[model samples]
Target: MSVRAHIIHAVTTSVSVKLMRGQLAYLRSKGVDLTVLSSPGEELVAVATQEGVSYKEIAMQREISPIRDLISLCRLIVFFAQKKPLLTNVGTPKAGFLCGIAAWMTRVPNRIYTLRGLRLETSTGLKRAILLLTEKIACAVAHKVICVSPSLQARAVSEGLVPLQKTIVLAGGSSNGVDTSRFATANIEKHTDLLQRHNIPPDAQVIGFVGRLTKDKGIVELVEAYQALKNEFPHVYLLLVGNYENGDPIPDEVKTVIKRDTGIILSGFVRDVVPYYTIMDVFVIPSYREGFCNVAIEAAAAGKPVITTNATGAVDTVLDGVTGYIVPVKSSEETRKAIRTLLCNPELGKEMGQAGRRRALNEFASPVIWDALYQLYGELINRR
Candidate 1:
């Protein structure tokens, strides 16, 4: 019954605190001796303190560097050899690849790879080939691959990255499900001060987005769509609630527009994003791909209708036309039309938002995902 588990990610700030938020703590509560590993940072320390779990700082690079990667790989092997954990649930591309090999070499009984998203989906040529090979090796060494969404699972299987039997999507499809209580409809009226601070007018319709402001996140298309949308609804505001990643930089012009446009409110990397959802009239995640649009469901929980694309992980987030519209990726026209439809019909938007909240409560709540994950962990440990 003693279950020692280690969760590994490339960085602590983004993945550990954001994507995998509250997950480690929940697992710890369920009699798991959980330890988190990521590159050293203040956020890593904060996460350990907040989650009340032990952690080890393992220096790992996000980008592909042969020399650094080998050093990181050796460090991982040593960690696994010393800790001898019953299960090691590794995630993010770099950590997964290195940790998978280390776990396999150290003969960890239950090696679980949490496949969040495939970078290979967007890459081409030499980079794509490298990503594909590493991902395949990561999956090959793992006892189980937990895909965050059904579509991601399907894509991995279709690409021969992982067999269908080895990959599974937990509960509905989200790495860490949305916290319904924090983003409930009752709390919608509580963020008036926040809106006031941002100088967002009470009467102005707000279009919100909460993710990396990067090219792959469909930021270019979103900017284009918002520009077209402004022609119809001048009083509208685009509230971006995340930071731009240096790795996948958006065009210089797009960045300029985002910075200079008076109507666009940019709040870079807010630690607590729950209240910001309340300020939004409609939320959009025009992403090229996702593990599962966590922000989409969070918007739903906040009683806000969402407009997302039919990308790999994004396609599974909404009910389409009922909860939100699913527009084609890279199409500013379709995105504009969806935004226009919701803006023009206030009643329809409200109804859809209500429906989305219901869906989030029923399927994508944090406890639901945690329970499923706990059961899976027990099953995996028992099998070994």
Candidate 2:
């Protein structure tokens, strides 16, 4: 069978494409003709070259702009009709909604909607209703709906967005499994220069957080917790490895603390985060919502103990008291306590980190996940 697939997303530089990088290349190697579509940028060219796949640029906005969205839908419909791909997988909110509709209208053989997360979980009033409607529409148009985590699947089913039978969590629960070899503990020595550049003392204990510096990520609480922890452990440094998003702005007080604190290091929008993970002794993601905390697994693969909130997807990522600790959502005191526990007991932290690495190697390896996804695609196409 001649199988052709198209993966669509709103932005080229975003996590959706990053997560699919290895999987896309692996699929291509297995004789699947692959094409990627996103808004045009230098990253689009880079991704196409890296993945060894054809790429088409479609200008799609992340926001709900009716005129632009209509243009994008028309373009996608024409593209799908002409290409007639065997499968089209749409991800991210805007692209999923628009491309799902387009693929459905063009009668694509296998329409896949990757429900990364429920934006409605954090929204309210009319906004929540609108998000719910769009989610329903996206799922309704697709033949298969892949949730990144089981909790997200349950949430969708409970919310009446999609039936349980229509959705599946691929492999265990990660959009992209962690690259264990790349994120392994061996890279720590190699990143000594990076530590020097950042003025991070070699003996300093590091608590790291990676992802957008937005309100929903619990950045405000994290900052407050870090301040409390700093009073106890002066040697502990907070390493934040992401840029701030304008959509969900963090409080001014948090921004002020970030700017004033000498112990806090912010590496804005890094391309390669493996080295950053290497320097961290403990990784923390106090997110209020997530499809799955990819960085948490990446940190685990790097042999660092994790401390994340008991949020839907996040809770699934870390096995509490085994690989890491899970505190209640929005609790700064609880977050501080978790951090202190890890920091105080160095041996315990090391043990947990080792356990996390083992778990990552066994369950969340990239090759394992890629193979599963490839097989699923074959199954999906053959069924069609």
Candidate 3:
């Protein structure tokens, strides 16, 4: 079972490394020599220690900066030349583009660009054109492109970002599959302390959302939907588990509502989201786009019915009407209707939750995805 290959994975920022939580360790256990490269931060240091892997820090920027980007590219080329890794797998828009070129320049036998999401999907005019060009360049230099979800893969091909032959979706559709055991339903008593700390009433039905509270995440629509239902459903509480981001900021008016609304409890940036999921009766992710909505699957693993949009990765997370309802992106009315339906018919929500849990266990388990990825890597390395 020895995999005598050296592989380096890169992302733009340290926080983005959370997307691959247990994945690098899994690859290491299968005997692949692994190294993580990202911008310098405590999270990166922590990941290196926790996963028992070597790491390199490169100050990569998320935004377009011509001067800094050129400097970063030069550094990447030097790093690749020094490491000479058998495979270079890079993700995040910035890292993917730079590392793809660096890996190609250094003649890395297996180059991979992990297509997380297409920012151009939401951009327009000049910005959209720039994003599209960068995506194509990243894909052009990489030997393989790993789209996290089936829909994302299809979108990449449809948009001509990458050819069908160069892209793949491992197992079902997730970057790192859900840790079902950690996210499953917990003892009611075990959640009491967390509920009390958050000041959530025990009898209140919670509608939860996780991930950044940004414009693209459809936070404005989520707020609108919750406000619409608030009067009719007095006991229903909206709990947002993540913090706001400066980039793609939500409308000021929407932010004001989220803060002023008595029913909405904002729990900014939690390390352990599993506990929060246990407190939720139903989960909602109204994102406009995603590579794959990990939180939606995590909610499913927690045995909660999910309401997400038909946007790329989000669309694949739930089985419409079965595991959860699928609403159109940015439709507050539809989002509100879906929320009301679940809140009114508790039994239907329970049924959907159970079905979602079954789907999570059967299709999106971590080991299943890790094994699939390992096999793919093995095939690629052997070809080299």
Candidate 4:
């Protein structure tokens, strides 16, 4: 087991490059030969160039399509057999299941499944069963399962998806910890034009969110909460940094409300989120589920306090009353209350934001997580 051994990392979509970029580069710098695989897209090309790693595009659909899945599975088996990687780490639901089975079939010595989040958490009936079954099979085939948060690992074990012995959380649980330097307040002035483009007043108190605008992300409740906050605080503004996703969409009524509101600024799917974070006075991620809310810590790294729901991985990103408030999942009233609390007491919010910055630097720095991952890979390779 040498650093020269081939290692393949697979994800369902190119968007996952945001999470794996730092780790891939870190491993490559350590002299490990790495190959990245995902569905073809501009993100895939960008990540490959950014990390200086070899990449292969494999078609993968996020939704269930039996015929397409079968074809993808067969293709993966052939690809795995050809590459014969010494280690294969697969992530996201589709890639995890397909690549896990393919790696096992090809007798790849070290197979790892990175369980970011469990879709079964929000799904119901037949969909829940299928998601759970896929998770079980993915875990069964992998030599190890790396959960991004302690709570996620606990839930998976409790649900019998993976045995506790095979699962572990690395370095306080984040896929790639925040780049503190990149997300700092020093970069705020560079993006002031972003405020002008969105027509957001310079002095407005901005409450921001940076994720897919979907039901699972608690977008409906967030809108309701925002509306309530607007009535109370005229200077308050909502800055949503992501786009509406087709899968698990937010209700049309919610979208209508967002469109009707002048105070809510939607910057759909921006490539660089740092500047958007700078414009935010307070960050909110009212997600109903998460595997570790990366955006919360990124906001924290940007010197902004966060208000997130007390859902599994979401809870781990903020220190309840210290870094910011934690409201119950789907509770717009509580979310509104937390937002009001931060808004009324700007001093308190500033104190919390400063605390959050310290916490992000101490607990979730990118280098720390990358070093832990590099060591984990070395240990797994030696064991194999």
**lDDT, candidate 3, 1-384, per-residue tens:** 235889999999998887777988998888889999999988888987899889999998899999999999999999999999999889999999998999999999999999999999999999999999999999999988999999999999999999999999988988789887786444312376777998878899899999998999989998999888888988889999999999899989888888888889999989888788888888999999999999899888888899999999999999999999999999999999999999999999989999998999899999899898888888898876
Q: If scored against the real structure, what TM-score would every candidate get?
A: 0.94, 0.95, 0.97, 0.96
Candidate 1 TM-score, true structure as reference: 0.94
Q: Each prediction's Cα lDDT score?
A: 0.87, 0.85, 0.90, 0.90
Least accurate 10 contiguous residues by lDDT in model 1: 6-15
Arrange candidates, best lDDT first.
Answer: 3, 4, 1, 2
Sort by TM-score, top down from the best: 3, 4, 2, 1
Candidate 4 stretches greater than 4 Å from native = 1-3, 189-191
Pairs with backbone N, CA or C atoms under 3 Å apart (clashes), candidate 4 = none
Better-scoring candidate (TM-score), 2 or 3: 3
Cα-lDDT of candidate 4: 0.90
**Candidate 4 C-alpha lDDT tens digits along 186-205:** 67543678889999888889
User: What's model 3's lDDT at 254?
Assistant: 84
> For model 3, where is the 10-residue window of minimal lDDT?
183-192
Cα error, residue 335 of model 3, in Å, equals 0.8
- Put down candidate 1 lDDT per residue, 81-195, tens digits, no spaces: 9988888888888888988999999999888998999999999999999999999999999999999999999999999999999988999988789877786556766488887
- For model 3, what is the error of residue 253's alpha carbon versus the real structure, in angstroms, after optimal superposition? 1.3
